[model samples]
Target: MTPLAISANGPRESYGDKLVLDGLGLEVAEGTVFALLGPNGAGKTTAVQILSTLIRADAGEMRVAGHDLAREPDSARHAIGVTGQFSAVDGLLSGRENLHLMADLRHLGRAEGRRRTTELLEQFDLADAAEKMASTCSGGMRRRLDLAMTLVGDPRVIFLDEPTTGLDPRSHRTMWEIIRRLVADHGVTIFLTTQYLEEADQLADRIAVLDHGRLVAEGTAEELKRLIPGGHVRLGFADADTFEVAVRALSRTLDDMPRDDDALTLQVPSDGRVRSLRALLDLLDAESIEAGEPSVLTPDLDNVFLALTGQPRTAVDPPADHPVDPLTEKAVAR
Candidate 1:
C-alpha cells in the first residue's frame, strides 16, 4: 500500500494567549491530493507551515513524508517541496535560469543540474519561453515556472498554498491539469490550501474545511456536499401533456414532488443514485410517460461551506482587513 506523505493530529499553535490552530488535524496519503479549505484566519497557513517544516507546532503529533516532524524536521524538509501563494521566481532571471538556480540549491552536479532544468522546463511547457525573463512571463507562466522549480528536488510530497489565486479561468484550469499530472505521473502527494471551493471540488481526493482555527468538516467532495440538503432530480418533458403524466407517475414513485408547468419540469427529492434513478425510469416506462431529459442536481461545496460555517462563504474574503491571529501570521510568514 502507498504510505502516508503527511499526517497530523490535534496540532495546536498560539501567540501568547491568542490561539491560532487549536487541535487541528490533517492527513495526506501518497499520490493523493488532500485539500485544506477555509476562510481567512482559519489557520490553514499555519497547518501548511507545520507540515512543511517551516515552523513548529506547539502541541500535536505530526509526520511528513514518514518523518516525525518534531524529531526530524530536516528529513521532512528533504521529502517535500513548497509553493507559497506568492511567486518565488525572481523577475530579473530568465525562466531557464530560475530553474537552474533551484537545481543548484538542491546540490545537483552541473551536468545533472542542466539536465534537470531542461526536463522541468519541458515538463511544465516552459521550453518555448525558457529564455524569457520572469518579469515578461504572464501570471500563468510564472506560476508554472514556480511549480517547476519546486520539483527540482524531486520531493515525494508538495505543499501548494493557493497555487491558482488571481489567475484567469483558463490559467486556473491549466494549473489544475498540472496538479493532476503531478500525482498521476510522479506519485507525489499534494497538500493544498485554498479559498477556492470549486478548485477543491475539482481536484482534491478529499477535503477538510477549517473554521476559527479548527476543522469543521472533512470528507470526499461528494460526501461533504451531501451533508447539505435540497438536492433533487429534474425531469423535463417536451410538453405539458407529458409533464402531467410524469407528475402522476412520479407522485406514485416518490413523495413531495414539485412540478412547474410553464417550464415543463418536475423536481423530485433524490440522492441522485443509480438505483433511485432506475426506479424512476421504471415508473415512467410503466406509465408510458416520457421525460424529454433527466438530470440530477446535487449540493455543491459552496452550499456545504455555508451550512457548516454558519456564515456565508462570501464573508471571508482573503483580502479583508480583519486581524489574523498573530501565531497564524507568524507561522505563514516563514
Candidate 2:
C-alpha cells in the first residue's frame, strides 16, 4: 500500500461553549486528492486548522508529510501549503511580487527566488499578468496567483478550503485542471474541503463526509454512492406510445415507474447491475416495447451526501459579519 501523507486519530476540538470536532479521525494517501466534504458548521475548516498546525486539538495524534504535527509542527509546516476560502493574494502587489514574497519567506536566496517566481508565473499562466497589480487581476487570475505563491515553497501537501467557491464555471474548471496537474505531475497530496458535491465526485480519490463534527461516511465516490438507495434505469422512447407500453408491461414486475410524458422517458428502480439490466431488457423485449435508449442511472455524490448527512446538497453561505476564527485566519494567511 502507498504510504499515508496525512493521518489523524481521535482529534477533538471545542469553541468556548460548544464542542466543534468530536474525536474525528482520517487518513490520506500520498499523491492523492482526499476531500473533506461537509455542510457549513460541520468542522471541515476546524479539521484543516488542526492538521495544518494552526490550532492545537484538545486531543489527537497526527502525522503530516512524515512529521508529527504536535511534536514537529515546524517540519509539518514546511511540507504543507494552504489556500483558504478567502484569497491570500496581496492586492497591492503584482503577481510576480506575490511569488517573490513567498520565496523570500521560505528563505530562498535572491537568484533562486527570482527563478522560482518566473517558473511559477509561466506554469500558472500568470506571465501575462505577472507585472499587473493583483487588485486588477480577475478572480480566476488571482486564484492562480495565490496557488502559484503556495508552490514557491515546494510543499508536498496542499490544503485547499473551498478554493473554487466563488469562481465562474470556466474558472472552476480551470482550477480543477490545475489541481489534477498538481497531483499528476508534481505528486502533491491535496486535502480539499468543499461543499460542492460535484467537485468532490470529480476530483477526490477518496471522500469523507463530516456531519455534526463527526465523520458519517468515507470511501471512494462509487463506494459512497452505493450506500444510498435510489439507483435506477432510465429508458427513453421515440414516442409516448412505446413508453406507455413499457410502463404497463413492466408494471407487474415493478410498480410506480416514473414517466416523463414530454421526454418520453420511464424510470425503473434497479441496482444497475448487469443481471438486473438483462432482466429488464428481456421483459421489454418479450412485450415488444422498443426503447430508444436505456441508461443505467446510479446514485451520485449528492445522494450520498444527503443520505449520510441528512442534509440537502446545497451551498450554505457563511453569515454576514461572521467573526473569523482567529486560529484559521492566522494559519491560512501564512
Candidate 3:
C-alpha cells in the first residue's frame, strides 16, 4: 500500500473576517518531495500549520501519517518534523548540545541519545563544530544543526519551510543534497514551501502554486514551464540585409516573428524541441540566408510563476516566535 504522509480536502482558515485558505486541498505521497510555492500571505505557512497540527482548520477532512489531524493532533505531531526558514538553534547551545536536547525531548535514553547525537553530528558535518555555540556558527552550520535536531524523532514526514532562504549558494546546494538523501535513503516524505524557484526546481518532484489562498497551478517543473507562451528560437545575423531577407523568407514559415533591425535578429516562436530546431535550420538552409547560431529560449520557473500565479516569490518574514523548533510553543490557539 502507498503510504500517504498528508491528505487534506476543502481546508479553510480565517483571521477575523479575512479568509486565508479557501477550499485548499492537498495530498502528499511517501518518499517524494511536494513543493508549495506562493507569494507572501498566500496561506502557504497556514497550510503547513494545519497539516502539522500546529493549527486547526475551520473545516476539512485531514489525515497525516495515518493520524487524523483534528482528532489526534498529538499522534499526528509525533509522526512529523518541521524545519522553518529561520535558524531554530538556540544561540547559547553548542551544536552537539542542540541535538542532544532534541534527543532528550524525544525521550531517547542516555545511550541512545548519545548515539543518535553522534550520528547526526557526523551526518550534518557538525562533528568538527560539535562544541561551537550556535551564535558563533556560520549560517550553513546553524541550518544544518536545525535540521539535525528535527531528525531526533525519526519522523516519517518532514515539513521544510523556506529552509535555505539566507544560506550562501554553496550552502543551499548542500541542503538540497541532504534533503534528497533523506528521502532516498530513509524513505521519508518531504513537504517543502519556499520562495526560491530554483530550490523548487532542484528538489520538488511535483509543485503546487498557491495564489490568493487557492491552488492556481500544480505540475512538474517542465509541465509548469510549458504553460507560458514565449518559449521560442531566435536567429541573429551580422547585418540588417541578411536579417531582412531571412524575415521575408521565413515570415510565413513560422508562427510569430518580431523583427529587430538594430540587433539584426528575428524571433520565431517554437516549442523548444530538437525537431523544431532542426526544421528551423533546414528552412534557413533551404533559403540560403546566412543566419547566426540558433539559440533556444524557453521559459523558466520565474516566467512560469509570474504567468500562472501573477506574483513574484518573496521571502516570508518569520514571526517573532518562529515555530520551526520542537520546544517553541507556536501552536495556534483553537
Candidate 4:
C-alpha cells in the first residue's frame, strides 16, 4: 500500500449545543490533491483546523506525515502548512519581508532564511515585486506571496481552506497551475476545501462532500456525477412520425423518458455506462428507427454537487469594494 500522507479515522467535534463534525474519516495519499466540499455552515473549516493542529478533535485518531496528531502534535505541525480562506500577508511588509518573517517563525537562521526567501521569491515569480509592499501587489501576486509564505517550513502536506476564494477566473486558473506543480514537481500533498466545484473537478484526485457535518459522498468527480440519474441520451429525429416511433420503440426498454414533440427529440435516461448506450443504439438498429444521432448529456459537477449536498454550487465573489480588472469582471459576469 502507498504510504498515506494524511488520515483521519472517525474524527468528531462538537460545540455545547451544535455538532460540527460527526465521525468524519479521510485518507489522502502522498502527492495527491484531496478536496472537501460543503455548504457555508458545514464543518469544512473545522476539519482543516483539527487536521493542522489548530484545534483538537473531540474524538478519534488523526495523522499527518506519519506523525500521530494526538501524541505528536508538534511533529505533525512541523510537517504541515496551512493557508486559510483569508490572506495572511501583512500589508505593511514587503513581499520579501513577509517570506523572511515566516522563515523566522519556523526558526530558520538569518542566512538560511534569506536564501529560502530569495529562492521562493523567484519560484513564485514574485522577484520583481519582492521589494514592494505586499498590499500593493495584484490579487494574483498577493496570493502567490501568501502561498510562498506557507512553504517556508518545507512542509510535506499543505491545508488550503478556500485558497482561491476571491481570485478572478484568470488568477483562479493560475492557482490551479501552481497546485499542480506542487504535486507533480515538489511531491507535496494538498488538502483543500473550496466553494468552486470546478476547482475540485480540475484539481482533486479525490473529492468528498460534507453535508451537515456528515460525509454524504466521496469519489472522483465523474464517480460522484455518475451517482446522479440526470444523464440522458437525446435521440433526434427528422420528423414527428419518426420521433413518435423512436419514443414508442424506446419506451419498451426504458422508463420515465422525456421527449420534445416540437424538436423531434426523445431523451432516454442513462447511467452513463457504455453498455446502456450501446444497448440503446442496438435497439434502434434492430427496429430500423433511423434516429439520426444521439446526443448524450451527462451530469456535470454542478448537478452532482446539488444532488449530494442539496444545494447548488455557488462562487464566492470578491468583496464589493475590491477592485477587479475589467476583463475579470466580465468573466465573473458570465
Q: Name the regions of candidate 4 deviating beyond 4 angstroms.
A: 239-244, 288-293, 311-334
In order, the Cα lDDT scores of the candidates are 0.84, 0.86, 0.85, 0.86
Tens digits of per-residue lDDT for model 3, 1-334: 7777788889887765667789988888889999999888788888887788776777888998989877888998898999876677998989888888999999999999999999999998997669978999888988999999999889999999889988999999999999999999999999999999999999999999998778988888988887888888888998878887888888776656887788888789987878888988998899898887888988999998888777544433235244443454233333
Number of the predicted model whose TM-score against the real structure is largest: 1
RMSD from true fold, candidate 2: 4.2
Residue-level lDDT tens digits of model 2 in 202-298: 9999999998788999999987887878889898988777877877888887766888899888889987778889999999898888886689999
Ranking by lDDT: 2, 4, 3, 1
Q: In candidate 4, where is summed lDDT lowest over 10 consecutive residues?
A: 325-334
Which scores higher on lDDT, 1 or 3?
Answer: 3
What is the number of backbone collisions in each predicted candidate, taken in the order shown?
0, 0, 0, 0
Evaluate model 3: give its lDDT. 0.85
lDDT of 4: 0.86
Q: Name the Cα RMSD for model 4.
A: 8.1
Residue 81 of model 2 has an lDDT of 96
Better of 1 and 4 by TM-score: 1
Q: Which residues of candidate 3, in runs, are more than 4 Å off?
A: 1-3, 236-249, 253-255, 260-265, 273-293, 311-334
Candidate 1 whole-model C-alpha lDDT, 0 to 1: 0.84
Model 1 residue pairs with clashes: none
Ranking by TM-score: 1, 4, 2, 3
